[model samples]
Target chain A: MRRLGAALWFAVHTAGQNFRRNLGVSLAGVFTMGLILFLVGGALLFTHSVDSVLQAQQAKASRIKIYLSDSASLASIMDFQLRLKNDPRVISVTFENKDQAAREAAQNPDIQAALNALGSNPLPASLNLNVRQLTDLGQFDSMARNTPIVDKTTATDYNPDVIGKLRTVISVISLVGGIIALILLVISLVIIMNTIRTAVYARRTEIEIMKLVGATDWFVRWPFILEGVIGGLLAAVFSGGIVFLGYKLFVQAAQRSLLSVPFDASYSAALLFLLVLGGVAVGAFGSYLGVRRFLSV
Target chain B: MSVALAERPIMSPAPALRPVISFHGVTKVYPNGTTALRDVNLAVHQGDFCFLVGASGAGKSTLVRLLIREETASTGRIFIDGHEITRMPHRKLPKLRRKFGIVFQDYKLLNTRTVAQNVAFALQVTRPGQRHLREKVEEVLWIVGLEDKLDKYPDELSGGEQQRVAIARALVHRPRIFLADEPTGNLDPDTSWGIVQLLLQINHRGTTVLMATHNREVVDLVRRRVIAIEDGRVIRDEAQGSYLREGEATI
Candidate 1:
């Protein structure tokens, strides 16, 4: 335990010393990591907001109306309404009687003129269904058509072509964003590895001397690994701040423009945490690999 | 067909007198197909000061490297203090290496660190406690006559001073054996003499000192046991020997 403590102290001290001594190189590494992380964070925020907007638009167009036949009884209509309400896909079901339908049509100027010309109530009672999912619309429509009392079923303002195009766009955006994020991650890893390699190369003699003095491989390697982790941590804090402020500003702008963006506090917190954790993991792993060749002596 | 040095008791009747280092038919061949050492057999007893004299590429450095476990032998076994180190595990190599302190021609001192820190580094790795670490560093620096220059970096010191710091680092660990690979190769005759005198003093204190060098004048002047190597073979092993073969012309 004592030896471990001493090793930890040495690693921490040396890591700090290395960072301070090579301030310019350290800053360059941090900046590179920050830039990569910022791009990745931006992509995440973009996809999340796009998904939220798609969901809001889908909700607006998910409503379907089932017209009741003239021979349909009130009790049967109520029973059908209860059955639809019990279905998980149905968000809400409202029953509109002939009187209510006629009243609503009279409120509309064009419908009122048509009703006045006809001189009779031509509007039929209908059951309005707001489905939770856009994909459930077809099943709900078929079920309503098969019902004995349902005259015909019509979905309100739902366009299959538009939804399909939007889905394709979302998938394409997610795939491209994910690929770009992965590339940035790989590039950042290589850069961190090279930075660590250079640091190890510069201190090659010190490493040799340490080996000659009977220092274990861990004794020599831990400092470089710690240095990498420190560099990554600095980058994380820097990039996290930038991403937080940028995302906040973006969400505010989206709000002002009447755009529905999904900006949850918990999600933002998780993203920040992942960025910091990823930075540390990449830095440590890179340093470990970089110093492996030098430790063969 | 070689006899083990551990079995031979001709050098001393005292039971405490043991071989500090032994090589029995040891051979080293690099992966690039260069044979550095060929069936070499040697032994150096505890408290013995031995000089390895040879030309460049005579396998002197290879032997030093093998002893330090930097390079493993292609065949045969080596023992240090009755322990076979030829097949020692990689994890155990560090513990074995702590038994010997090694110096190089380039001094290998960290230029970024002060003389005191350089010396203290050895102890800090092997033994880590601030109070004893400071005392040992001061003592070793004092022995190398660099106590006053403790805070000076390698660049701030002369070549001789730098070598002295290296020696101080090597000695700070209080190793049982001191291995010097051309300790004075980069120094002037006067500075070389000073470093040699320090090694002699270290040997006088009962540390088995094995130095690989091409300094003929120092070897001839010191008149110590010289093991001369030629083409990866020991051509001569004589106490109070000269640098070259008998009656050989000085190049």
Candidate 2:
């Protein structure tokens, strides 16, 4: 246990010394990692916002309307509304009487002018329904159409074509964003590996001396590995801060433009944590690969 | 002053003599189809000072490399301290290496580290105690006469000082055998003499010294046991031997 502690201490000490000694190269590596992580974070935020926007628009279109028969009794229509309100799948159901429908149309100038030209009220009373799930719409439509009080069921205002296109757009955006993030991750790994390789090359003589002095392979490798991990962690903290501040500023700007952005602070914090953890893991892995080829002696 | 090969009988030490190193029919053939050593048989007893004298490409370095287990023998077995290291496992190689102190022609010292740290590095790797490391480093540096320049880096030191630091690093572990591969190869005559004298003093302290050198004057002056190699073959092995074959006259 004491031996392990000493080894760890030496590794940490040498890692710090190596970092300080090669400040310029280390900074370059960290900067590259930070930039890549920033791009990934931005992409994540963009995809998340777009996803929420599409969901909100889809929610608005998902509302289904059922037309009531002209001869249906008011008591039956009120009973139907009360039954739907108790249904688990139904979010809310509102009954619009013929007079109320005509009044709402009269509020619209174009509809009011058209109505003034038409002599009698042609619009029917209807029940507008909001469902918990989009899939529940078809079942609710069948249920409403079979009812004696409902004369006809109008197809949902939700356009399948527009929904399909929006879904495609979302998928394409996510796929493209994911690909870009993956490419950036690979780039960061290569940069970190090269940086560590250069550091190892610079200290090739030291490695030779260490081996000659009977230092175990781990003794020589741990310092470089630790240095790499430290570089990655530093980059994570830097990029995390940048992403946090950048996202906050973006949210503020979006609000100023009267655009509602679904920014979740806890989610963003989780993402930040993941980024840091990823940085540390990749840094250690890169360092391991970088020093592996050199430790044969 | 002179003795014939037949007249100068080979001193056959008692079988009870504990050998620090022994090579039985050792052969080394690199992957490039170059045979570095062939069917070599030799042994060095404890506290013996032996010089390996040969021209370039005569397998002197290869011998040292094999002894240190840097390169494995292509054939035959080698024993260090009665442990057969010819096929020693990779995991145990480091522990085996700690038993001998190896120096190189280049005086391999970490330029970024101070002189004291350079020496302390050897002990730090094998023995893991900070307090013990400092004391051992100080003791070894004092032995090499570099106690005052402990804080100085390699670049700030002269060739002799740097070589002394390398020696100190090698000696810090207090190995039973000291192996110097052309230790004076990079130094001037005066510097080389000083380094050779230091190795002699170290050998005098009862540590087995195995040095590979091309310096004929130093070899002749010391008149120690010399093993000469040519074309991967041990052509001569003599006690109180001179550097050159024809100059094998006792001092």
Candidate 3:
């Protein structure tokens, strides 16, 4: 019972002293921990933003846009829309008459001038289709071409190149964020371990004194462990606070600038939990390792 | 000040209680084949203040180490409270260690802690309840007469003060017996007696004290139970005074 009481008091007392005594080191530890967590949180937010943005822009259109041959009749357009809608991947298809084409173009200044010069709705009618998901873009484009619309059907002006480039960039950023976070976490642990070791070295004389006074091995060791835990916890709290502020601001900026893209900036609870858990884990583990290594029998 | 043990014209011998600590033909050989102690037999009875006088390597340290359960003996059975300690496992060592307070010549007070912290550390480490730990620390510091210096760190105190803190730490737990290994080796003659006086005072309260030292004047002047050791064997054991419960040394 006495030993256990000693353990608890010593744990608290040592951790407090360690935090105070090693302020510079402790701050450095906190900074590293917070930065690592921030990186992780930031990457997750960005990925979420990307997914939300894609989700909001609307479902992918059927990979094929059908342009009727000049001689193709209205019956054939109706037949094509019906046939494509029944296909497994197809969601919906709409037929636009030549008059609708001329009307849409007349809204564009350059295209309207060209239409007025023609002085009539001479453009062929077309079909606009939407698909359920973007699965096999190449296969989708091929299926659209084979829709037998009795004319040439092709991909529209949606720019697949841009989407592809954005996806690639997101993947790289996520991969880089993951690597950096891992490296920083390892570095934080090392710094904490080293700090605890230094404290042990400083207290070696005190330990020898305890031994002479008939203080047991356990009695001598517990205070140092307590010190480590204290150091770790302080670092954690500091880092956690910084991460909370940073991500909040980041989410705010995202919401403001990317109004068209929907982003949830309300995951404050999860972020706080991550910070606290990280701090406690680092402190406890750091203390355990320091005592284990430095206080070896 | 608490009653200064008046100068005694003659001291009385303590009644012989059961030997608090007994070593039976104890022999200890080091891992390097250095025979530190060989066939040493000794006993320390309760309320008897005794000193083990020997040269540096006369197994004084090893024997003291054995007494505190710091190191075990090689070839002999030892007993504290009649319990065999020869093959005692380490997990049971703390309970045995708590039975006695061990002081050293260097006055091993924890320098990082204040005087109160050092004294309190003993009870605190033993896991006593908070109230008892505080009360006991205050009581022991009062006994050592350092209640005013509780906040002073070990480095801020004199050698005598540091030793007093160490003594307070040893005594705070109120062990059944006291052990000192050259407790006065680092102090001057005057400071040495002051510490000895404290030991004598504590012995008066019925706790057996076994101090190992080579200080001839302390041995002759105090005239308590003096046991001389040389070459791992007991040369003398004599009781010179009656134990007083809480008064000046009539012994």
User: Which structure among the candidates has the greatest DockQ?
Assistant: 1
Query: Which structure is stronger by TM-score: 2 or 3?
Result: 2
CAPRI-style docking class of model 1 based on DockQ: medium
* Order of candidate numbers by DockQ, starting with the best: 1, 2, 3
Q: Native-contact recovery for every candidate?
A: 0.60, 0.56, 0.33
lDDT of each: 0.87, 0.86, 0.70
What is the TM-score of chain A, computed separately for every candidate?
0.90, 0.88, 0.72
**Which 10 consecutive residues of model 3 chain A have the lowest summed lDDT?**
A55-64
Q: Please, what are the lDDT tens digits per residue for candidate 1 over residues A114-207?
A: 9989988877889988988778877877777788898754323246667667778777888888898899999989988898888788888878
Candidate number with greatest TM-score: 1
Model 2 interface RMSD over true interface Cα atoms: 1.5
Model 2 lDDT tens row, A17-61: 989999998898888888887888777877777777777776876
Compose the digit string of candidate 3's lDDT tens values, residues A114-210: 9888787777677766766554445656655665554563323244665566566656766775677667778777877776666666666665555
Instruction: Score residue A267 of candidate 2 by CA lDDT.
Output: 81
Worst 10 contiguous positions by lDDT, candidate 1 chain B: B6-15
- Scanning candidate 1 chain A in windows of ten residues, the lowest lDDT window is A152-161
- iRMS, candidate 3, in Å: value is 3.5
The residue-level lDDT of candidate 2 at A116 comes to 86
Residues B177-220 of candidate 1 have per-residue lDDT tens digits of: 99999999999999999999999999999999999999999999
